[model samples]
Target chain A: MSSDHSHLPSETELRAKALESLLVEKGLVKPEALDAIIETYQDKVGPRNGAHLVALAWTDAEFRQRLLADASAAAAEMGYFGRQGEHLKAVENTPEIHNLVVCTLCSCYPWTVLGLPPVWYKSAPYRSRAVSEPRSVLAEFGAELPEEVRIRVWDSTSEMRYLVVPMRPAGTEDWSVEQLQRLVTRNAMIGVEQALAPERLAP
Target chain B: MRGGHDLGGRQGFGPVNPEPESEEPIFHDEWERRVFALTMATGMLGQWNIDQSRHARERQHPVAYLEQSYYENWLAGTEKLLIETGLISEGELRSGAATEKCGKELRIPDAEAARKILTSGGPAAREIENPPRFAAGNEVIVKRRHTLRHTRAPDYAQGCRGLVREHHGAHIFPDANCDGEPVAHHLYSVEFPSRELWGGGAEPFDVLIDLWEPYLTLVDGNGE
Candidate 1:
């Protein structure tokens, strides 16, 4: 180590070193094992998994009821609930109003469903606008609620987590339950976008 | 920059903010490093070019190369870790057999896993726990608590009077001073006038908060 450690390592490097040193001190496991475990879990239990579950729940009423009532347990039934997702809750959207979730402090999200969060969820524009100017944020996602309709923005903290269950769209009367289910994207359930209609995907 | 999880009513970027804290070591080792090194090692070999490619559509500017370089340096460090840890063999890294898992399923897809996770405990069992001292329609006040840790109960709501409308289940307590156990706490649907929380010309009926039970004290008729 040079005396002119003035060119100190970047925050990223310092954090990584700190974590590595902590793990070494704890003797919990090797860095390699931790890396491999993270890789495996992140790969297996990322956001796409949650999207699929939302798609299924959208198509099933009984399951949706179970989910809204007990999100953590319901998520576990699909293998999406674990250490990170133990404190999950799903706030549903309705035709009358919409719900959009944001992490005002840090990006504390239900990683089990929505993988590594998109850069925007952790951005200043989102954290600020989602609370003060929520209507505009919703507009960015093409979800414009009526002026009279209330917009509830759930700010997730460390303990309580939130998920938005979007409303079912119209014009899918003839579509099979399975076909209608495909229209539910991760953004839709997050209240950013309304569920896509069957025609929206038509050629 | 606030912590990655602390952005409330702030603005910048398009819903994306990098935590000022150092990158999570695990992520640095895996993706950031892998992508950067692969780009650079190939650049040095003369088989790949950097300047001309820097002006690609995604870059939208020539300066992106600098950003990429910074990212590349971080990536190389993680790759070195991978090699040291035997996560990938030297031959594999050289032969392009060192596959980096991106957008790949780990075991089961997250979407599929979500279904099971959400449905695991039946509906009856998932409700928020009842606070030892309160119930629905009970008049209570938000307790004033502060510390240096992740806290779910907001400070503004402290000392505010409201009715306990619902009971959300027990969760991992974020108050750093607590025992770290998953304690039982009720989630209340506390109603405050927009005037009450905002303190100026707030809507008389515009009141809302899904507060935890611990953030409250019973309010007497005097509005204390």
Candidate 2:
């Protein structure tokens, strides 16, 4: 079935503005609501939430078990439940095995936890190749796992979103949750990079 | 439908040169934010389900589907759904005019509900009368052929043999969700060997997909 509105593809920004103005004029979508939604994701929700969960898992073992068992509920306990995160699954990276997340069909991410996905995560190259050649992808992201280590690529095909809990750095065993939170970066939780070691912290 | 949106195991895309996370902005420009907000807010109208909205995006011409940026597709899909659901029209879309107040009769969410809407996301899982057909540790084969309508079964895993790793109880069936009454089926996390999906030269690893019951069939004890 061909689209009659084929001409609408060009001038993306202009078209977006037209649509928004139409909706706002019709009293269907409030401009303030759009600003609120944008602000929520932009300021409040994002990688910091995932970092908090990772930091807690590192400092508290029982929370880690709960998180691994039922991520959605565990996340809700810390108030990290929302869109793209209803059925969240937390995957732990161990010395013997590594985990990476990708959505081949579309970008399905834990929006509430990790905020918006990075551009590469939604790009065609990463979507097409991540599942096929994860070692190369991981290497490009500066996460070079040993050849002996197994890789589990979780394709987010369904509603079940995944978050990789990167192995806690060795030297930070005694670090506080607040300090450990600083080491957990957004890319690390996506399995593209490992959590930063204590010495790597910024001066 | 081996829709063009299915990018798994496909080749020839260049390196994924990701921007350094320190500098990458969540929304590259203001329009992206508008598109996202508009899509999410429009989605709150309850005119269409998530599967339908996704189909709107995937059903576009392959060139449009692949060439457009992520948010561009979202805008395209939103426009398509808006027109298809009678919430808007091609004329209105073109003129940026609400002649009919097409959305006047609709139940639209306001600014106060943004937080509630994002946090209490639309959960797809449901309780159905039928019990799950497959269980953990069961060997299964993905059915090669199914309807051409919207489906979650990816092209790479079609007709391949795999093991049932886990069973997620009844959830909304995406394929059947294209039309008619809502239905739910058991969704299983099926694990296929990378070699099986790509080739023997593929990096040794496992690729797992969440497939509904209809997309799979049981394999014999002989591993046939």
Best by DockQ: 2
Question: On residues B1-224, what C-alpha lDDT tens digit does candidate 2 reach at each position?
Answer: 66768898888777887888998888877788899999988988888888898889988887777777888889999999999988888999999888985635676677788778888888889998988878899889988875568888888889898889998788888887877457998999989889888878888999889999988888974432
Question: What's the DockQ for every one of the candidates?
Answer: 0.15, 0.54
Query: Which residue pairs show collisions in model 2?
Result: A46-A115
DockQ-derived CAPRI band for the predicted complex in model 2: medium
Candidate 1 chain A lDDT trough over 10 residues, lowest sum: A1-10
Off by over 4 Å in 1: A1-11, A14-28, A174-181, A199-203, B1-7, B10-131, B143-150, B159-163, B176-196, B199-210, B221-224
Per-residue accuracy of model 1 over B1-224 as CA lDDT, tens digit each: 12222334434435323332123322434344334323322222222122112212112222322233233333444444434444444554454332433221223213333333333421211334343466677787777765543355555456667666555544333342232334445455555544455466432223345665455677763323
Q: Using TM-score as the measure, which candidate wins?
A: 2
Model 1 Cα shift for residue A131 (angstroms): 2.4
User: When only chain A is evaluated, what TM-score does every model earn?
Assistant: 0.78, 0.93
How does model 2 score on DockQ?
0.54
Task: Compute fnat per model.
Answer: 0.19, 0.74
Model 2 misplaced regions, further than 4 Å: A1-10, B221-224
